[model samples]
Target: MKKVFCIGELLIDFVAEKQGSDLSKATYFTKKAGGAPANVACAIAKLGGRSVFIGSVGDDPFGTFLLDVLRENRVDVSLAQRTETFTTLAFVSLAENGERDFVFSRGADKELQYNSAIKSEFAGNLIHLGAATALLGGKLEEAYGHYFFDGLTKKSFISFDPNYRADLWKNKQQNFAKKCMTFVEKADLCKFSLEEAQLLSGKEDVAEACRFLHEVGTNIIAVTLGASGTLISTREFQETVPSIKVKAVDTTGAGDAFIGCLLQQIAALTNTDSLAGDRDLLVSMVAKANKAGAITTTNYGAIESLPDQEQLSA
Candidate 1:
């Protein structure tokens, strides 16, 4: 089986359930592990897949808890690093329609540095770039750039999720847009929410956004349309995945679960089949992944609500 390497931030999220997307009058907050890459790693592991997470965290109680959380989900954290800084944290407020608002603090996660751990990780067959803080033009950029670029020529299925954090960019809109676009151009499978797709591509229209992304070399684009399902577009094909009815309680980590389940399915392919080989197969996989995402929303927190193989296969 191919190993899945997820490179990005590892942090804690405090989620609050409320009547609507507004967080002004939230009742209570529940803390849980989060970060797009970490969520994907957990999702893949839940499906009995070999998954690894590569990133840095503060050597604090929160960091330790995050490490334990990853290991508990059967994700490999040997490549994960820890520092003496404070761990990153986010407060999320969920609405009745599954929308969420967040207040993020990247104290230590901003200081996370990439090192010599993943020069050989490209052989893992899949590498997912899903963190907003990753391409912040630091020493970590050079480190991640080396390995990510190296993966370009290797036998790896490169996946990308522009898990854009508006707060991370702040006022550097031009710089952030450039950085994400460059990463998108490198991925074999690209995942984005409608907002991210529009923001990254600067095109509000879905068809145009997909076309623009494809022209930039992203062969497979998965644009998540919230409750409307997903738009799976390839250079040669297009697919719109629909979701099943579910009572969503919290939307935290739903997108990551979708990607995680999608990767788990791809890892089962015995041959050297590319991810964009068949449109029908990709649609089916996305449908299953959609269910995985929807299932997570029925409960609180992220990993705490992720569906296991039994739930998904049922």
Candidate 2:
């Protein structure tokens, strides 16, 4: 299988141990390694896929622990960098129904500087632009663009998930919509949550939103519909693959798990071109990925909750 390269933030999440929606009422919290791209990298590795994580974290205990978690799961983190700044931290409060409220202290995650030399590292592999903060500017945003072109030039398959964080773009929805599509237009596969789909395409209907996204340029578009499952679209096929039913506990990593598993499956195909053309294969793959997502929610924390190959097979 071709290695999947996940580029983006690596941070710590301080989750309220008491499950309730209000962040103010929370009395205590627990720290966990949490970041969308890092979660996806760990998810892929846990599922027996080769993955590489490229990003930066502070040269602090939190950063060290985050890297340790990734390494423990077998994700290649040689490209991960350590910075002098503090590691980014997110305080999360979970409602009884698994919804989350967050407050962020952004730091080292934004310091990822783009390196042209990394272009040679992605040949015929997969590059996933799965960062919520990458589009927010600074060196990380620059790296996001460079990696996109690097993937193009290296004959690598590109996947993108806006991983939209509403907290980060509070009053900048329009700007978020505009910048995200630039990536949507370049990706081979684009993943979106229902809210993200509606926001970006200006279409409330999932099908219409997917159509708008497809027309823009992405070869395959997937709109996640929470418990209803995922709606997948391509020029040749479109269908909703139902999710595996489970009693979800924490929904934090579900989307990341879904996309990570799907990317892993895509990496296994010798001819990457089949991803855009194979309907039955893609459907089967998404169905499996849906299960991965469902299973993830049955536990708490992103990396720790992701299902392993054994769990997935069973």
TM-score for all models, in order of appearance: 0.93, 0.98
The TM-score between candidate 1 and the true structure equals 0.93
Which digits, one per residue and each the tens of the lDDT, describe model 2 over residues 1-314?
Answer: 89999999999999995469789899889999999999999999998899999999999999999999999999999999899999999999987778898888999999998888888989989999885988989989998888998998897899999988888999999899999888888899999999999999999998998888989999999888889999989988789999988887789999999999999888888887777788888889999999999999988788999999888888
Clash list (residue pairs), candidate 2: none
Task: Output the number of the lDDT-best candidate.
Answer: 2
**In candidate 2, which residue ranges exceed 4 Å CA deviation?**
none
Give the total clashing residue pairs for model 2: 0
Name the TM-score of candidate 2: 0.98
Q: What lDDT does candidate 2 reach at residue 124?
A: 85
Question: Tens digit of lDDT per residue, candidate 1, span 1-314?
Answer: 78888988889998787656666778787788998889999999998999999888899999999999999999999988888879989878888777888778876665656565466667748888885677776655665676578677676888888787776778987787788777788788889989888887889898789999999888889988878899999888887899877888888888999999998888788753566868788999999999999898898888888889999978
Cα displacement (angstroms), candidate 1, residue 126, comes to: 0.7
Pull out the clashing pairs in model 1.
none
Question: Which run of 10 residues does model 1 get worst, by summed lDDT?
Answer: 110-119
lDDT of 1: 0.83
